[model samples]
Target: MIEFTNWDILRNLLLAARWTIALSLTAFIGGTIVGLLLTAMRLSGRRPLQWLVRGYVELFQGTPLLMQLFLVFFGLSLLGFDISAWAAAAFALTFFTSAFLTEIWRGCIDTLPRGQWEASRCLGLNFKQTLSRVILPQAVRVALAPTVGFSVQVVKGTALASIIGFVELTKAGTMLNNATFEPFKIFAMVALIYFALCYPLSLASQRLEKKFNGSR
Candidate 1:
């Protein structure tokens, strides 16, 4: 067994943590774009568009994210698009985040008073204008807390990428533990690292939720 110093193991894990943060940011940003498009489609006038968005949200959110990662990794290769596990993991996580975010934001949109829609219609704002100018501005307050909260989930979800051999923090810990034969110490460090990453976001989300709700 290799002799592993705590400092050596920690240095490697900290380096690996950068990839986890990068992956989470990538997924959150990509998912926001996709989720916005999905929310628009789901709330669109056309029934078919609504149904299509609904189906997509259901397909991703209903299934396990692990399965989605495998499908994107293995299934995409079968389809002849060679993808790195990094690419596959990022893509899968983005879609997974989009599905949940679309649902969350949709609920926020739904919470607006029914009168707001009628008022927008009365003022000659079309659906797009009303949503962009009137409804979304108000709904944003409600959406902020949940959206921030969902980011924590996205960060945690990056750990799932380890299963496909992506060398983010968790994978690094596994490899270092295997080499050093020190699972307890290695894993404890890993958990602390994850907590360090996640806890701040959790606190910020709670604060935002209180601020938003308190304002109302």
Candidate 2:
């Protein structure tokens, strides 16, 4: 058994936390890009495009994220691609984030008054112009709070990445526990680290929601 000093345990956990942050950021950014595209497609007003986007969203949203990670990591290997744990985790989480984000933005868009759309069209604006100049601007206010809140979920989701051999906080905690036989101490620290990271975002989300709602 290895004897890890308290400082040593904390230092190692802190190092592992960096990867969790990195993975969350990567997933959020990538998911935003993909979610925007999917949102656009869903809003395109063509039946086929709507159907396609719905199917894509449902597929990701309906399945377990852990299962998705498994498929991305091992399934790609079956197809002869050398998929690393980092790459697979990022890919899976990106799609997972995108699906939820697209839905969130869609709900925001739906909340807009119909007159806004009609006015934009009356001004001879095309769909793209109307969306960019009017609809999205309003929708963004509604989307911002929820988007920030969902990021906490993404951060928590990173724990599962450790299962596929991506060594982040949870994996680090397990290793430390095994080495030191200090499950309570090590896992408590792990939980504390995650709460420290997530609580601020949660507070920000609530603040934004209140601020926006007050203005309206």
Candidate 3:
């Protein structure tokens, strides 16, 4: 085994942490876009569209994220897709994030007073107009806090990407541990780094919740 200084291990882990953050951002942004489309479909009140989006959300949310990663990373390869660990992780996590985001946003929209929809209708506004002008503006306030909160989950979820050979922070930790045989110390640092990454988002989510709730 090669000798590694503590600084070497930390420095390498920190470099890998960049990929973790990058992956989280890629997944979150992609998920948000897909989720908005899904949310729109769910709100369209078409039975076929609603059922389709529902199945999508259920398929992602009902299953384990690990299994999803495995399928995307390995299963796609079996089908001759030649997907890389990075692409597979990004694709799987985006789907995973989008599913939860769809539910979160749908719940937000549902919480709005029913009269809002009716009032918009009475004003001669169609479904699209009502959604853009009335429903979404209001639902956004309710959704912001929870949406930020969900980002913490997204960050934590990136750890599972390591299982698919993605060289993220967790994967780096495993590699360093294997090299140095210092599981306890290496993982303790991993946990600390994750906490550092996630704690501020957690705190922000709470603060936003309080801020929005107070305004409500």
Candidate 4:
């Protein structure tokens, strides 16, 4: 058995944490882009477009992330496309995140008074122009707190990537536990590291909501 000091274990876990952070950021950014497109389509007022976006959201949201990971990681290979664990994880999480985010953003837009849309029309703006100029501006503010809040979920979600052999924090911790036979200590540190990462974002989310609400 390889003996490791506490510091040595922590140092290794910290290194592995970078992959978790990188994966979370990648998923969040990719999700944001895709979510924005889905949101736009959802709000397009065309039955077909809206229905298509709805179906996309439902498919991802209804399925498990682990299942999605398996499909992307292995299923793609069946189609003869070479896929790595990291790529599969990123793709799965991105789709999953996008589904939830699109819904969150859409709900925010829906909360606006219809008068906003009517006023924009009075200003001779088209549907696209009104959305870009008026609706989205106000909606974005209400969306910000929740979006920031949702990122904590994204961070936590990265743990599932380990199932597909992505060498992230949880994976590293498991590997360390196998080597050191210290599941209790190693996993405690793993939990601590996750708290360290997530707690700040949770606080920030609350603060944003407070600050924005106070101003309004």
Model 1 vs. true fold: TM: 0.98
Cα deviation at 66, candidate 2, in Å, is 0.3
Cα displacement (angstroms), candidate 3, residue 181, comes to 0.5
Runs off by more than 4 Å, candidate 4: 214-216
If ranked by lDDT, best first, what sequence of candidates would result?
A: 3, 2, 4, 1
lDDT of 2 at 74: 99
Q: Model 3: how far is 95 from its true place, Å?
A: 0.3
Candidate 2 lDDT, 1-216, residue by residue in tens: 667899999999999999999999999999999999999999889999999989989999999999999999999999999999999999999999999999999999999999999999999999999999899989999999999999999999999999999999999999888899989999999999999999999999999999898465
lDDT of 1 by residue, 42-75 (tens): 8787899999989999999889999999999999
Indicate the worst ten consecutive residues by lDDT in candidate 4.
Answer: 207-216
Clashes of each: 0, 0, 0, 0
Give the TM-score (vs. native) of candidate 3. Answer: 0.98
List runs of model 2 lying over 4 Å from the truth: 214-216
Clashing pairs in 2: none
